[model samples]
Structure formats: C-alpha cells, structure tokens
Target: MLKTLPADSRPREKLLARGAAALSDTELLALLLRTGTRERGVLQMADEVLQRFGGIAGLLHTEPTALKAVSGLGGTAKRAELLAVMELARRAAAQQLKEREVFSSPDAVKRFLQLHLAHKAHEVFCVLFLDAQNRLVEMRELFHGTLTQTSVYPREVVKQALALHAASVVLAHNHPSGTVQPSRADEALTQTLKSALALIDVRVLDHVIVAPGDALSMAEKGLL
Candidate 1:
C-alpha cells in the first residue's frame, strides 16, 4: 500500500486530505510522529511500537529509552513521542482523578488518592478540600510520618481548609506495603482527626487508604 500509490498517497497526505479521524491509529500516530527512516514507513514504525510494547495498554507503561531501541525510532522522535504520551496520560489521569468527584463514592475517593498519593514510598497524610459544588479546591499534605507515626495536625488541616474556603475534605494516605486494609493506627487517627476537624465546620468527606493498585474508603465501610 505504501509503494503503489505515489508518495503523495502516503499516510501523511491521506491524513491531511481526509481529516485525522479517518486515519487508522497507526497512521494518526505516524503523522504526529513525522519521520521514521529509509527502511520503514510511518505505518511500519507505528506497527513496531505497537508490536514491541504489546499495543496501547503496554505502550502506556513503556519508557522512552526502551522505545528508542526500535530501529526507526532513534534520536529526538523517541523523546518527543514518549513525552507526548506521558504528558497526555498524566493530564488524563489528573482530570479523571478530580472530575465529577462524588466525594461520597468509595471508588471515587480511591481514584483521587491514586492520582495524588498511591505511588509514594513515604507515608504522606494529605487532605483534599472540596468546594460547595463538591469540586476540588485544594489538596495539602499536613504531615509526613515515619513508618510508624503518620500523625496529622488537625489545626493545620482546618487552617488550610479554611484558608482555601473549602466546604469539606477527604483525607488520604498511601500504604507502601500495597495493602488496602486500614491499620488500627489509621483508624484511630481518622477518628481523632475527624473529631478535631469537625469543630471547624469542615465535613470529613471520607478517609481513603491507597494501595499500589487498590484503595479503601473508611466512610464506605462505616468506619467514619
């Protein structure tokens, strides 16, 4: 298909003529990606990317350095495409993480935490402040704890929430151990902080415990 149709009939030209929506995934990627090498056309280059990475899902996890190992993808194109995808994914994850936040949903609370803290090795106790519309206003980490003490200062929590003019807050933390179960200390701290924060008129939306790939909401389990 690349040869018989003149260079004018190439993927780039076809894309320009028929709009990007009419192009195949490979063709669309190839256009944004511009040049491959003499040995491969844009489709072949895109095919190599898909084949080596095991398709789009695998591509998401692929690193730029690793991707450059492919034949046609050496030099600037490598970093450009990889960074493009990474930035797009980071932005997408951020939007999905905060958009339509139901504040009350177990999964929704987890989604927010996964965006904010699940990957950290250290214990970070953070708060998500919500507006009257229940949209996100601000998020702040009130404390960082050693392996044992993830103590959060309630006064500071209330202060930040009040400073941001937030109507409510959802507390979140990460368990490097990858367990979604809340520790006894986690539960005790939540109750303590919840009680303290309540006095300031900011509702505790939920206390979320984030694991590497999963999360648990205290409110969902009636723990809050």
Candidate 2:
C-alpha cells in the first residue's frame, strides 16, 4: 500500500518534506510502527491501533500487557519501541515541570499528571511537591483505592510535605471511571489537605483530576 502511494505522500517522505505537523495521526503512528502484519498495511494497522486505544492520549497510557493483546504489537521490537516512546514523552514532561514553575504552564501540569495517573485502574492520590520557587521537587503517590477524606490522611500528607520541605503542592488523582468532574468527596478531601498543609506554611496550588484522555484543574475552576 505504501509503495502505491505517491513518494511525497508516504509517511516518511511527507514528514521530511512538510514537517511532522503536516502528517495526520495515522501517518505519524505508522512512522513509529514501521511495518505491518501479513493481513494489514502499516497505515491500516496504525489507524486500527489508534482507534482501539481511543487515539494518542489513550495510546500513551497503554501498558505492555495491553500491547501484547494487540495483533502486530505482539512482536517484542514494536512493543519495546512503543513503550520507549511513551517513557520518553513522560520524562520530557517531567523535565519541563522541573525547569519552570509547575503552574506557569497549566497545560504542562495537566499533561504530566495525566501521564502518571491516567493509566491506573484504581483511584490513586498523588502529590506534586513544589520547592520555594514553585518548581517540581517530586511527585509521590500517597494513597490508592477509593479516595475519600477518610482514606487520604491529611497528617501523612503533612509529614511528606515537611520531609520534602515543599513550599506548596498540587494534589492529583485519577478517576478510573473516566469522569473529570470533582465529586463532593474530592472537594472535601482537598480542603482537608489544604488546612493540614497550612499549619506548616505549605500552600495547595491546585487539585488536578485526570482520566485517560482528560484533565481538570480545581484551581482553574475556582474550586481551590
């Protein structure tokens, strides 16, 4: 199929001639996949893979075990390449947060949180510890399972904040159900952690809710 396309229109040639931004998602993914199985063309395989995972954001969160279930990705090389790209993307986002104020680029914060938390099958409560300059000090998952005021202890959060000497924090959690809306319990837990961190002069910068392809910031919503 690729051989039949115009030389300038193939994924590799199109990218070289027009820049990567000109390629559609299927074309870009085909460049990464490189080849196809006996029954499918590379472009068709890439399109099916993206559709199966619900597009790029969902694909970024795919696990190795999940990839094994896909047809062409059963091979080690393709799976490894795909996983490596995802890890590189995650690290790049983290590095960006480390170099600048965590909130300076609100989209970056959400993207970072989504990479880390959006893949979980269960609820995960994490904290982004920020230094005095508001740069990322560390991101740690403090709780898992159903998140509630009772399940996520404020004292434990206080302890970690004191240990990291964080000046502020961004609380984040994933909703495996795929809803980005903050529940009543989510609001209460944020308040609880905020008051606890306040005793040690640490601020709660934001509470971000993430799902596979979405993120919402409580601070942006004026809920914090």
Candidate 3:
C-alpha cells in the first residue's frame, strides 16, 4: 500500500526533500526501521509500531521485547531503531566532550554524562580525572554493579586520581529505574568518595546521579 502511493509520498523521500524536521515521529523512525514483513513496507510498519509504543520517547524507553512484539517490527527493526537512538545520543555526547573542559564545573559533567549514562539499566560508576587547567584528562569506569551496590573503593579511586595528578574530579553513576532522587546509599557513597579524594587534594566537584530523562546533583541538593 505504501509503495503503491507516489514515490514522493514515501517517508524517506519526503524527509530528503523537506529535511528531517518535517517528518512525523513514525516517519523518522521509518527511515531507521527500514524494512518489514512481505505485505507492508517499512514506513507503514514503523507507523504501526510507533502507535503501539505510544510515541518517540515512549519507544525509546520501551523494552526490546515490547518493541519486538509489534507485528512488523521484529529483531531487525527493534535493534536498528535502538542502535540508532543510542548512536545519536553518543554523537551528542561526543560533541560536548570535545568542546568542554571536564573540571570547569559540575554542571558540565552532568550535562555530558546525562546523555549517555542516564538511561543505563545497571549501575555504572564513571570517573573523570581533570588536569590543572581543567582540560580533559581521562575517564575510567571503576566498576559496574547491581542495583544496591557498586564495588567502587575510594582508595583505588583516589590512587588513580593522584596518579593522574588531577586537579579535580566528578563522580557519575546511573539509576536504572529512572528516578533521579539520590538513594541513602548514593549519599553515603558520595561522602566516602569525597572524603577519600580530599586527602589527595583532588576536589570532588560533584557527584552526579543520573536516571532516564532526569538527574540529581549532590552539590545542588546540599548532599555535598
């Protein structure tokens, strides 16, 4: 039915002609979903899937199986759409990473990581070590862990920060359930990390806890 329409009527062609901003959510996704079962073309399939999922953000938040259960969107469409969203997010983050100084302010770190780590399912403990002029030094994942705990020991963290001779650091982690509110464990862990890094004179600029579409800052919330 979709192919039977004028070629100009296709979502991809319309996007190319008018630019991506003119396309509907389904149309945009159709360009990425790219294929369907024998009868329906990818555009129609993408429309049906978006309707089932509710909207673009809804589709972004949905589980893989939920998307796969849609009739025309199975493994290929689901993975392609998911990968496309992640890749877009990565590119957005890379843009920020290249232009900004890591240690300049806590907000910079929050804005940068929130794009990438905010929606992660399990806990991801990432560290940013910054130099004297506050330029990019290095970032490392100290640990990944279950919901309640991460194996991030401050001694090792401080040791690494000192080895880099970092002037300051920002600690970032994610809540899988999409609540930006810091847990009691999150608070205590930040305190411990802050205290340990203090002895080495490496300032803990912020402890950022990210959730899907939201985040909490220890400094802003007075937890720092």
Candidate 4:
C-alpha cells in the first residue's frame, strides 16, 4: 500500500524529505511497524493501533502482554521494538529530571510522571525522590490498587524516603477515571504522608495526579 503512494508522500520518504515532525502520527507509527497484516494496510493498521490505545501517550504506558494482543504487533520483533522505544522515552525523561532541579521545568516533571503512570487500567501510587538540590534521585511505584483506589502506607513511604536519603519527594498517583482533580481521600493521604515524612525531615514537594494524556500539580493549585 505504501508503494502505491507517491515516493514523496510515503512515510519514509516524507520523513527523509521534510523531517519526522512533518509526518502525521499514523505515518510515524507506520514507519515503525514496517509492514501490515494480510487484511490491512500498514497506515490503516497504525491508525487502528493508535485509536485502540487512545493515541501515543496511552501507547507509552502499554505493557508487553497487552502489545501481544494487537494483531499488528503479533510478531515478537515488532512488540519488542515498540516496548524498547517506550522505555527509551521514559529513561530520557528521567535523565532530564536527574540532571536538573525538577521544578525548573514544571512541565518536564508532569511529562515524566505521565510517561510512568498514565493510561493504566487501575491506580498506581508512586514517589519521585529528590536530592537536597531538588534533582531527581529515583522514582518508585510504591502501591498498586483497584480501579478506584489504592491503599498507600505513610510508614512505608517514610521508610523508603529514609532509605533513599531523599531530602524531598513528589507524590504522584493515577486515576483510572481519567480525572486529574484530586479527591478528598487523595488530599487526606497527602497530609498524612506529609506529617509522617516531616518527622524524618523529608519534605513533600508536590502531589501530582495523572490520567491518560493529562496531569495535575497540587502545588500549583495551592493544595500542597
């Protein structure tokens, strides 16, 4: 099918002639896929895959097992490539945070969290541990819960913070309901963790709520 298009209009040619930014999402994805199933064109399959996962942001959080279920990515090679690319994107974001004070680029922090937590079928609570200079030291998923809620233990969070020797932390959790607005329970848990960590002299910098393609910063809202 790609062969049927003009050479300048084909994904690879267009990417070479104009640059990757000029290509549509479907064209970029089709370039990665390389080939299509017998019944579908690569462009069509790529579009379907994007739609199935709710676009590129959702695809970033996709698990390997889920990739296998997609007919277009049925081959191990294809799935592995996709997984590798997603992992690389996450690591790149983490590296950026590790190199600078996270607050210096508020949007980078949210993008990093979204790459790690968004588009999940259930909830996840994670922490971004930071050094004295506010550079990211590490990120850990401390809790996983059902569709609506996760039970986070303040003691465990404090313990991890102590172990990591982190001076502060950015608390984050995802809402499967696709809402980044913090709930009352979310607010309560933030205060509880803030109190628990204060005893050890670790500050709670912010609480971020993540959903598919979106994130909210409680600090920006004066909720922290």
Highest-lDDT candidate: 4
Tell me the lDDT of candidate 4.
Answer: 0.93
The residue ranges of model 3 lying beyond 4 angstroms of the native Cα positions read 6-9, 38-41, 47-85, 102-111, 133-135
On residues 95-213, what C-alpha lDDT tens digit does candidate 3 reach at each position? Answer: 56546765455566666676667655678899878777666577777889987667888888988898888888878888887788888888888889888888988888778888765
Q: After superposition, how far is residue 57 of candidate 1 from its true place, in Å?
A: 8.5
Worst 10 residues of 1 by lDDT: 103-112
lDDT of 1 by residue, 1-224 (tens): 46566765577778777777777767766766666678777677887787776665455545557766777766775567666876576566546545666544556556556655655666889888888777777677888976545767778887898899988888888887768788888888888878887887778878888765578888878898
Whole-model lDDT, candidate 1?
0.72
TM-score of each: 0.63, 0.93, 0.76, 0.94
Worst 10 residues of 2 by lDDT: 144-153
Better of 2 and 4 by lDDT: 4
Ordered by TM-score, highest first, the candidates read 4, 2, 3, 1
Residue 203 lDDT, candidate 3, scale 0-100: 85
Off by over 4 Å in 2: 146-150
Q: 1-224 in candidate 4: lDDT tens per residue? A: 89999998799999999999999999999999999999999999999999998888878877678889998687789998888899999999999999999999999999999988885788999999999999999999999999997999998999999999999999999998988999999999999999999999999999999988889999999997
Indicate whether candidate 1 or candidate 2 has the larger TM-score: 2
Taking every candidate in turn, the Cα RMSD to the unseen true structure, in Å, is 5.5, 1.9, 3.6, 1.5
lDDT of each: 0.72, 0.91, 0.74, 0.93
Residue 156 error for model 3, in Å?
Answer: 1.9
